[model samples]
Structures are given as C-alpha cells and as structure tokens.
Target: MEETRIRFGIMGCANIARKVSRAILLTPNTTISAIGSRSLEKAVVFASENHFPESTKVYGSYDAVLDDPDVDAVYVPLPTSLHVRWAVLAAEKKKHVLLEKPVALNVGELDTILAACDSNGVQFMDATMWMHHPRTVKMKQLLFDEQRFGQLKSVHSTLTFLAEEDFLKNDIRVNPNLDSLGALGDIGWYCIRAILWAHDYELPNIVTAFRDPEYHESGVILSCGASLNWKTNGKFATFYCSFLSNLCMDIIALGTKGNFRVHDFVIPFNEKVGSFYAVDNSKWAERALGCAPEPSELKIEINLPQEAFMVQEFGRLVAGVRSNEAKPENKWRVISRKTQLVIDAVVASIKNGFVPVEVVY
Candidate 1:
C-alpha cells in the first residue's frame, strides 16, 4: 500500500493558519503533518485547539518543521516581513511552499523566494483562495465572450472590513513591524489580484495612487485606493481597500458590450455556492424607460470551501513533482510575481507624491 497524500507542515499559529489547517485536513490529497511556532507551548496548544491528528508533530521552531523528513510541503502564514527568509528556506529544504499573500514586502523579495523555489525544484503558490473558486473561472469565461463582454473597458473593486477598536490598536495587520503594508497588504492585495485576474494577469503600464490614503500615524496604510491603466489599450481598473469600513467585497467590470458584477469576490456570503451577474448588449426600451434585458444570475456550487480547493490544487502539484518527477507549475509563480509587481508599483506611486509610476515588470 502506497501513501500518495501530501503532508503539509504549517509554520506559525497566526489566526489565518487556523482556517488553513482545517483546509489541509478537508482536502482529500493533503494532511496535516506538523504545526510549528516560536513557542513550543503555543505549537502544542495550536495543534490541540485546531484538533490536528494525534500523529501530527508539534515543533517549537519553523526550522524543525522544514527539517522533518515527513513534511512534503509547508504552508507559510508568517508575517510579510518574514516571507522571504522562511519561504526561501523552505524551498532550500526541498519542501513545496504555499505562502500567504501579499507574499513578500516587495517584488524583489518575492523574486528571491521564487528563485529559491526554482533552484530547488519545489512548487510555489500564494494563498489566493478566490482564484480557485469555480465561480471565478466561469466569470472569466463570460468576460472573454466576444458577443457578451467584448473588450474589457474598465474594472472597479473594493474590499473593506470594519476593524474593532482593539484590532485597530493591536492586530498584526496594523503593526508596522509585522504586516507593515497594513490594509494595503492585507485586504488590498486581493483587490489588486482581482483586477489583475480580470486582465488575464497582464501587468498594467501605469499605477497612480489616490491622494491622502488613511494612515495609522505609524505610517502603515489603513485605507487606500489606486488606479491602474493600460495606456496602449486605453483600459483601466480602480480599487479601494480599507480596514475602517463595513465589510464589502465587490467587483464591477464593464466591457464594450456588457457588464459583470460580483458582490462577494473575496469570501462569498454563501459557503455552499457562489454567484455573479452579467449582461449582454440590450436595446433601449421603446419609450426610453428601463431596459427589459436583465443580467443573468449564474451560480457555482462547490463541495469544499475555496481554501480547501486551493489546498487540493497545490497538493496536486506537489504530488506530481514527488511521484512523476514532473516540473512544478510555473503559472502559479508567474501569477504571484505579477501581483507583487503591481503592489510595489502602487506603493511607489503613493510614495512619489501620488504620481503615476511605471510598472517595470
């Protein structure tokens, strides 16, 4: 009897790790191998609180997880500041790396991580859960339908969640020494990724940030917005992300012939199913009244949450590498790099007096 399931070691007990641990357990081809934190007691308690299997190892140091012979991959939910150091180390250890987004402090750091993964021949994927949703796939199809969507004209997205007073004061996302980019790194990452996804991972030619982004006094961004433009095609995308508003995840994409809309692009309101609305060209009503053609509501049902699907896909890549000696999927690495490039450009735009910064990558 052969065991083909991929074993995942998670580093850090960050709150998001709790959901990822569950996703690893729920994914059919993946299993929790070890849980590690800087504090041994924290690791042990995290393993128990998360109900990890009795056989799962609890290590006090991240290096211990990477050294464990049983660990085939590592899920890194560490702070953005630690991503390059640990992700590169995990790759150096010959372990596949599933990193949380924003994957690094900047594009340069992300490249170092990617280079390590490439040199080590291990898979590299950022934890962008929504990209794996079936609903997102269907929406991409609708957007490319010549008769329906035509050329992509513009995109607008927003991802914001109200933070409790305590969270605003103490959460890692707000701590400049930790999450650093703050709201721009935490939630804005998704908005930028969504816009890039709409553009088929194409890098925008220019990025101009909105003025006076709300900042935490510590200089970490609390709320921000940016506009990306493809000068050649005259198409553009705009997005806003914040930690000081009621929760909202919306995407509106208008095309030459139609429009596409999704209210819950990051995390769907319904766990069992997700949906979006789209419309094709519709004529004006006889009396210039309301149009008769309504946008169609399309829904996608899934057996697992988007995170579990992410684990499943990542594990599939690891297994292919381990069993068949197949090359790791480079598309995921490319997708991650493009996302980081835009993030860096946005930050540069903000820093350079809200001037448009040319995207070098």
Candidate 2:
C-alpha cells in the first residue's frame, strides 16, 4: 500500500508554489515531504509560512530534495528557463515530475525533458490547474456534442491583470535573464492552453503574433497577442495576454449552432465555485427586439480547489505506476508538447516581423 500514498518534494519557494503546496496537502494521496531552495533560511521560512507538515524536510539546495529517496515526485514551479534543467534532473533521479506551465521555453527544451522522463519510466504532467476543473469537463462535453454545438467556428480569449509598479520593475517575469518570455510565458500560457483545449489539442497550421508587442527595458514581453489558423477546416482562434490591463480572464467560443463563454477561465473568481455561460441556437425574435433563447448561466461547485484535483490525479497515476498496474500516461506529455510548440511558433512569428509561422507537429 506504500504506492497508494505518494510523497512530494517541492523544488522552489515561488509564489505559485504556495498554492500548489496547499494542494498537495489537500490531495488524498499526496503529501509534501520536502521543500528546497537555494537559501536554507528562505526554505525554512517558506515551510513555516505555508504550514507544511512538521515532518517535512527543508533543504538549502534543490539537489538535496531530488536526492531524497523518500520523495516519489517533485512539483517544480521554477521559471520557464529553468524547467528543462531541474525537471530533467528530477526525472533522471527516477522521480515523477509535476511541472509548472509554459512547461519550457520552447518545444525543443520540452522534448529533452520528455525524453528524460521516458528513459527513466517516470510520469510527467504540467501543472495547468484549470484542466482538472469540473467546469472544463462540462464545457468539453458540450463542445463535442454535434447536436448542441455543431461545427466550431472561432475562439477569442484574453487574460490580463494590472501588476503593481514594483512588479513591473522588479519581478522575475520581466527580467530578461530569468523569465525572458515574460507575460507570454506567465499569463499567456493559460490563454494559449485554453484555446488548444477548446480545439481538442489540434495543432494550428499557422501562427501570427500581433504587431507591436510591448517589452520592458530588459527586452522581456509585457503584453502580446496572436492569431491562429487551422487550415483544413478554416477554424481560427485569437488570444491576448498582458500585465498592463485591468483584471480580465475571458474565453468566447462560437459554433455554428451554439456559443460558449467564461469570464474567469484561468482562475475562478471565487475559489469554491465557477460559472460559465452558453447558448444554443440563439436567434433574434420579435423584429430584432430580443433574442429567442437566452444564454444560460451554469455554476460548478468544488469541494477541493482545482489545483488539489490536479495533484490528486497526478498522484493516482504515480500510484498506478508504483504498483506495477500501469505505465506513465503520455497524453499529458503530448498536450504539453503541443502547447509549447504553438508558443514557439508564436515567438518565431514575432521575431520574423509578424509573418505567419507554420506550426509543425
């Protein structure tokens, strides 16, 4: 029964890690067994502040956490640039990896990480919390229902938040050396993932970055947008991400017979429940005075946070592998690779003067 309970080691004390650490604690089959940071004091402070289990070990170096024989998995919330290095090492050490989003700087780096995990026979999953949300499952069911939604037409998504002056100036996200992709890697990752999820992970044929991306003095992106085209059937999608706008996370998907929308797609406005709107066969009525069918508001209640659900699902897979009952799931790996591939294409398009860049694989 040892495999039934998966012990986790946290790789960094990033702000996002705080939320995920709570998730590990909340998940039934997972526990935070260790936490590591470059500074021992910082690690200690983080463990204490997050109220990690008293038995949780604190290490001054990330290597120490990976070296722990008791750690069945590692939750890596490091920056995009550091993902390949740490995640690969974690896999090579025979530890399952729950990596943070934008999984890597590009597809090439992600491939390296995936290869390591494959060679070591360990699980790999990105920490895209929304994918585990009940609301997302319901939405997917509706989108796939031909009778209700018909053919998909287009999607528009936006994710933005106003960062304080200090963050704009001092945050690592805007630091070229640390998080060069900036807002694109941070918030934009969610927007791109949402679009892909809506399209059922089909790779776009061409990606074009919107003209005039705003960059910090360090040459890190602060705001950007992109348009994606699926050549075969002419399905198109657009997404925008920024750190200069008021709080907004929205997705609008239109189909031939129905429309779907969610104002808070990245993170629910309230932690306990989330809502989305949908309309089927909506049409004008009474001389265009009103619509015949009104948009329906639906809400999903969550007993545990979405991040917790993500952890629990990851733990289930790890347990299955540990018990010799199943192999590591590559579905999540493929999804992560496709997302990174699109991100790479978008960056390439921006560098090539906004020309359309074909997305290969």
RMSD of each: 1.2, 1.1
Question: Cα deviation of 95 in candidate 1 (Å)?
Answer: 0.8
Among all windows of 10 consecutive residues in model 1, the one with the lowest summed lDDT is 1-10
Going through the candidates in order, what is the number of backbone clashes in each? 0, 0
Tens-digit lDDT track of model 2 for 201-303:
9989999999999988889998999999998667999999999999999999998999889999888999899899999988888789988688889999999
Q: RMSD (Cα, Å) of candidate 1?
A: 1.2
lDDT of each: 0.93, 0.92
Q: Show pairs that collide, candidate 1.
A: none
- In model 2, where do residues sit more than 4 Å from their true spots? 1-3
TM-score of each: 0.98, 0.98
